[model samples]
Target: MTELVRMTGIEKRFPGVHALKQAQFDLKRGEVHALMGENGAGKSTLMKILSGIYRPDDGTVEIDGQPIELSGPKAAQAHGIGIIHQELSLMNDLTVGQNILIGKEPRRSFGRLDERELNRQAGELLGSMHMKLDPKTIVAELTIARQQMIEIAKALSNRSRILIMDEPTAALTDAEVSELFAIIGRLKSEGVGIIYISHKMDELKRIADRVTVMRDGEYVVTVEAADTPVSTIISMMVGRALKEETVTIPDLDTAETALSVRGLNRGRVIRDVSFEVRHGEILGFAGLMGAGRTEVARAIFGADPKDSGEVFVHGKPVSIGTPKDAVRAGIGYLSEDRKHFGLALGMDVRANIAMASLGQFTDMAGRLDEKAMQATANDYIERLAIRTPDDRQEVQLLSGGNQQKVVIAKWLLRDCDILIFDEPTRGIDVGAKGEIYRLLAALAADGKAIIVISSELPEILRVSHRIAVMCEGRLTGILPGGAGTTQEEIMHLATLRDAMTEEHA
Candidate 1:
């Protein structure tokens, strides 16, 4: 294989932060090299330098064995480099063909836009990549997975030989992931080098040829994927050994029922859902995508309207027609898409922490007590082990894991007893995941009723005292959470609909 990209002595700095320190990375043609790290490990910072999004304060970038200084994104693209960010960057209002050839659209005589040629070229590119999308379809009407494919199409349209994919499978289904891997295979055969960045350790085995680990903005080590253990890679990334242990179910027979839901229904999305979480207990929700796990949580939290249901807090029925009402009834919901639904990204950590319970920090004259808010925010910041310079730091500057902790702090400051966490560790790194798991356990031990909804079966087993499985908007079964419960059992309950369909046939 030929060397495609190399960066040596890469260094970058921002105000009050050293984003990268003497970092180094290299890629070879026809290889998939993975970059693994914790949320704040500077993976994005390094990649930004490679993709011309940011210029390193000190470093040398070489493309195709030739040293080059990339002035901007266009310069990098001119050198056959393309990056697809974690957040899709397509214009939703445009057609797929228009987005794919945005600035490079073909023109006819008299300098008129050649719409037909544009669609034809886009169709050819999608077909070559084995995508089944029509070029004329509106971008906003496609699913996340399909939109991801379009991003790839757009990258390939630039004649890119070096491709960088960041968290590409985060929003994809199993079938979609298989499709993506197939495309990667095709690209590799064509001698295209790929830099894959993802937090899902399992993917390294399936797709990556080599794995590179970075920690706290510095290069650690790189090794062949086939010769390294996942544990070794994790240790290199987090600087410590992580204990993989199952949950120890506590005896909650005498515990008070903190939250109860009965006959919950919302159109066909949620059908007759019912569950209970006792004080000092963690109840896990497990199911396939679209299995109504999130829907049930939203209805219970009053984020979505439930056609028919009764919510009981402390064994007493409560009316929760709105999010404010649910909060008043001692319920706090952490949404799965935390960036959009959970936090004010531009606000400081102190303001975001006090956002949920502003009234508590306000005096009779309607003036906020800034000192009190700062004191409370700082306390939670320390208690939660949030890695931030101070409470006044912008939440957007923090990593994904720390931002999630801030959301948790907001709810805790509100003093909600019944907490519902939806995909609490989604998009978070493994090291941070352990911290979140510990936090959930401590909260449960402190007698806070908790409901955790997760797509990953192992996470559900690790955090829950009891597991509730759903299928096609209905509760299939509930099982004990521990070593006694296997992933197979959870899968069976999750695919109950398929089993029933076969039986009926």
Candidate 2:
């Protein structure tokens, strides 16, 4: 194999933060290299430098054995580099073909837009990738999985030889992941060097050829993916051995019900859902994609309208028509899409933490008590172990794990007794996940009722006292969480459908 990319002694520094230090990496043509790291470990920063989004303060970069100074994204692209960010960057209103060939559209005479030529090229690219998508379809009309395919198509349309994919499978289903892996196989055969960044350990075995671990802005080691254990790679990334433990089911037999929902329905998305979380207990919701677990949470939180249901908090029926009403009734919801729904990314940590409960900090003069708000924010920041320069730092500047902690702090500051967390640790690293688990346990021990919705069976088992499984908008069954229950049983329940529905199908 020929050397495709090499970087040595890479260094980058942001205001009050050293993002990368003496980092080193190498990639060979026709291979998939996995970059493993915790949140804030400088993985994104290093890649940003490679993609020309950031200039390295110190480093040497060689592409195809030729040293080059990348001035911008165009420079990197000219050098056969392309990056698909973790966040989707497509224009929602644009058609698929228009987005794929946005800047490089084939033009007609007089430099006019050639719509037919553009669609033809994009359709060819999509066809090459075996993506069954209409080039004329609006991007917003597609599912996240399909839109992800468009991102890949757009990258490949640049004729990039070195491709960088960040968390590509985060929103994909099992079948969609299989399709993506097949595409990666095709790209490898064509001699494209792929830099794959993902937190899902299971994926490395399927797609990665070499695994490079980075910790605290420095390269730890690069090992052959086939020869290295998943545990070894995780240990290198987090600096410790992570032990898998099952949740210890607490005795909630006599505990009072903190949140209760009965006969919840939402037009085929949620059907006759019923559950309860007791004080001092954690109840986990388990389901596959589109299984209505999130819909149930949103309905219970009053973020979505429920056609027929009853919600009771502490044995008192509450009318929750909106999120504000739910909050007033002692319920807090942490949405899965935290960036869009949970936090104000542009605001400082102090403001976001205090946003939900500003009335508590208001003075007699109808002005916010800045001192009180700062004191409370700092206290929660310290308590939650959020790694930021200070509480005054913008939440957008913080890493994914820290941003999640900020959301948790906001809910904690609100002092909501019945809390619902949807995909609490979705994109966070292993080390941060441990911290979140401990925090949730502590909250439960402190008698705060918690409902955790997760797609990972292991996560549901690791955190819940009891697991509720949903299938096709219906509550299939509930099982005990711990060693007594296995992933197989949960899968059976998760795929279980009503007899009538199955018969109709």
Evaluate all candidate structures by whole-model CA lDDT and list the values in order: 0.90, 0.90
Q: Write the per-residue lDDT of candidate 1 for residues 182-276, one digit (tens) a residue.
A: 98998899999999999889999999999999999999999999999999999999999999866678889999999999889999878887778
Clash totals, every prediction: 0, 0
- Model 2 TM-score is 0.93
lDDT of 2 by residue, 182-290 (tens): 9899899999999999988999899999999999899999999999999999999999899875577888899999988888999998998887889999989987888
* Residue 324 C-alpha lDDT in model 2: 98
Q: What is the lDDT of residue 82 in candidate 2?
A: 97
User: Where in model 2 is the C-alpha error above 4 Å?
Assistant: 106-137, 141-143, 499-505
Look at candidate 2 and tell me the lDDT of residue 329: 93
Q: What is the TM-score of each candidate against the true structure?
A: 0.91, 0.93
